[model samples]
Target: MLDQVHLPPLAQDFLAYLSLEKRYSPHTVQSYSLDLSQFFQYIQEQYGGIALDSVKAAHVQSWLALGLEGRKKAEDAHKRAQPPASAVTIRRKMSALKSFFKYALRKGAVKQSPMARVTGPKLPGRLPVFVDEHVMEKVETNQAGDDIPLFSDDFAGATRRMILRLLYHAGIRRAELTGLRDGSIDFSNGQMKVLGKGNKERIIPLGTAVLKELREYIAWRDAEFPGYAGGALLLTAHGKPVQAWDVYRTVRKALAQVTTLKKRSPHVLRHTFATHLMNNGADINAVKELLGHASLASTQVYTHNTIEKLRRVHEQAHPRG
Candidate 1:
């Protein structure tokens, strides 16, 4: 493992800029740091060592190739060769290099970035996986049954239901839902304020049923843990803040019984929300805003699922017999 002190100055500067100025989430910044550290370690091994700004496009390409080859094993003579990194992983590493070089150029640390000429490996397109509408409805309507462990009277049960409900109805990311405060929801207006990527805020309208459930959950939470005075909207039975994994586990447990879809996590609920909206004639732009997506391109992927739904409807309904 490369030590922090050993990282090149330019790389350090770029990471600092990402954290301090760009205000990227810690998770995102950590990913960039890991990607760059691996690249730099490859640099020390291959080229003895070179400044980040002085590195060329060929070096970046070589790094990608090495990443795919599993780090050129030197640990043991009889050690089994490791499998190559996936295309997605390689793409993210290259993206980090490209982003770092771009920042270096902007900061006048380098006159030109070698990544300007470097192109990432071609990645296979995968459609966003979502829960089927019938399955989702089943999960939503089915109360604290055998699959879902939590009962409404208990703290765990109420929180689990609230977690699933907000993710399905609001279509917000898990992080946004995790950071939600007591003030995030406006019961009167039936709207929710969500903090998305890069700390961007967006308002999501809530349905009447969702609003009613929110009110019930709040009342139950207060009565269950009266002394707690935290700002977080959701809390554990002990009145501690809810973490991301807590939400994930709750979502996973709730979804396991209903969804045969392999990726049964909270995010799939977001996809289901978007897919259902578009299938029911919601505008693409409107869904984009509700989803807190920065680009229309990101939102357009849901259209593929919608189009498939239309195709199935046409085949089933059109009978000229």
Candidate 2:
């Protein structure tokens, strides 16, 4: 999809800057590429392929308007129109254009950024969705009882359980979990190093229970795939490295058994991890470091969830009337 789009040389250079200088992940770079490609395609069709520096704020506004209101197909008069973009999608496209124009200005390609005059719609406040502590415990442990292990005694089961545990316990992003290496775990320090966004590494402390499970999982993995010398911590049944999609599918299937939440992904486990820590009175800064968040603002969303929980408790436990 990224290759299909014909981006100008300046756009390609901007993408290189994101990948090399900014150290953005491939997935993030691809998203920017897609957004830029779509914008350029619109510019080509609407304005007859104007130079980047000549593009005006009105062009940017028109492009955004088209996104908010679905564009009708030119060739098919009777065909249904494409659905309008959601607030989130429009915001992302706006961000992509802003970043690209900023980069172009720095490179002296553009005298000014059109996005300086543009504004995105304000998104409604939405709290992060996380599983309850009890629900997560049920998912981790046996449905019959808490003492027994939930996963089967097989290599596949062991890997799946490890994926779930690391996501929830370490509060690592899905990419960070997949990027983990065999050497990332330090048994002596009781902490594991996670490679987070922008290739930043953070150390997450592991509990004794998690350490015990890690040791068992390592033994099982080695035994199942003997003579395998891959550096990846997680592997498929064929001994190849596990991918991001594999992690998502594994988490989705496991969470489906316990949670009815529409979002049954590894991210839900990460959210659950942060929310549970906040609920249990963990400091915001400590949780921020544990989750490898770039700023306190990103970590503060969990506090709202904690406040909601406190409100519910007060309503049920306290009686004034």
Candidate 3:
């Protein structure tokens, strides 16, 4: 049932390399496969059997142009047509191409990369979306009042609450959180050995409050699932390992109670973590390490959110008028 119709042999080889050697997540590999497939399909239909290395810059340019305009005709009438890809998506595809070509060049599959000189669509710089500090506090506490607790006192409630707390306090990605095993948490050191993108590992320090919650949750989990043999740090009602979607939905529902942000995701907690750190005078480089970013550029985005917050405070509190 595997469709290898339009994918060129070299492209297929490159994808295997990404999966096997680069250790990219399946989702990332699948994305690269889709992007490469689109490019190769366009090349086969439009240019007719051009060699992989012989592919011109114009071919890549034309493919991107068609994607942006949504002008490419669907291969079949049964397929639902999608709108033009947004700039962000287009940029991602371009990056995929760049990475693929880099691999291809190293293997001598291509003389040079067509994407070397090709420029992708300019992406608009947007600040990281985060919940306000006060809202985040409500999300974490879920205190009992005249109303029901935000996170109830059941296993499901504890798992959901812990998911949010880990994401916010650790500033870890959804995948990192989902992939955590019992051994991933180093309780003795107050740190977590997170396996980030590309199988890279970094030690993220866990705060005292988060560590306390984690211990309580672990005790609760052991008692709730006495026969639990699963290795994942989090589990479902059936004592099965938690999947990415499980964490996403749990965070989504938890965030819905506390935030009005249009995009309520576990990632919002990550954003909130970095932003709060910057607001409290945490160094950007230090936050970068905590967030496990490969480069400072990626971490710098959170600084904008903090700067905007400072601007608001200055506007409201400064008595120049």
RMSD of each: 10.5, 10.8, 10.8
- Model 1 scores a C-alpha lDDT of 0.84
In order, candidate lDDTs are 0.84, 0.87, 0.86
User: Model 3 off-target regions past 4 Å?
Assistant: 1-122, 143-146
Candidate with better lDDT, 1 vs 2: 2
| Model 2 lowest lDDT segment of ten | 142-151
Question: Per-residue lDDT for 61-144 in model 2, tens only?
Answer: 898888888868873576567788988999999999999999899999999998999988778679988999898878667452
Q: List, residue by residue over 1-321, the lDDT tens digit for candidate 1.
A: 555655688788888899999999999999999988878877887898877667898998988886677744585456466678898998898789889878888889888989878877678767788888777776577644566534455678778888888899999999999999989999888899999999899999999998998888888888988886859999887788889999999888878866667788889889989999999999999999999999999999999999898889888898951
TM-score of each: 0.62, 0.63, 0.63
Q: Which lDDT tens digits does candidate 3 get at residues 1-321?
A: 223578877778888988999898999999999998888878877888688878888989999988898753465465456589999999998999999889889989988998988998888898989888888878767853346588878898888888888898899999999899989988999999999999999999998888888889888888989988758999777777889999889888877776678898888889999999999999999999998888999999988888888899999999972
Tell me model 3's lDDT, rounded to 2 decimals: 0.86
Total clashes, candidate 3?
Answer: 0
Question: Backbone clashes per model, in order?
Answer: 0, 0, 0
In model 2, which residue pairs have backbone atoms overlapping below 3 Å? none
Candidate 2 Cα misplacement greater than 4 A, ranges = 1-121, 144-150
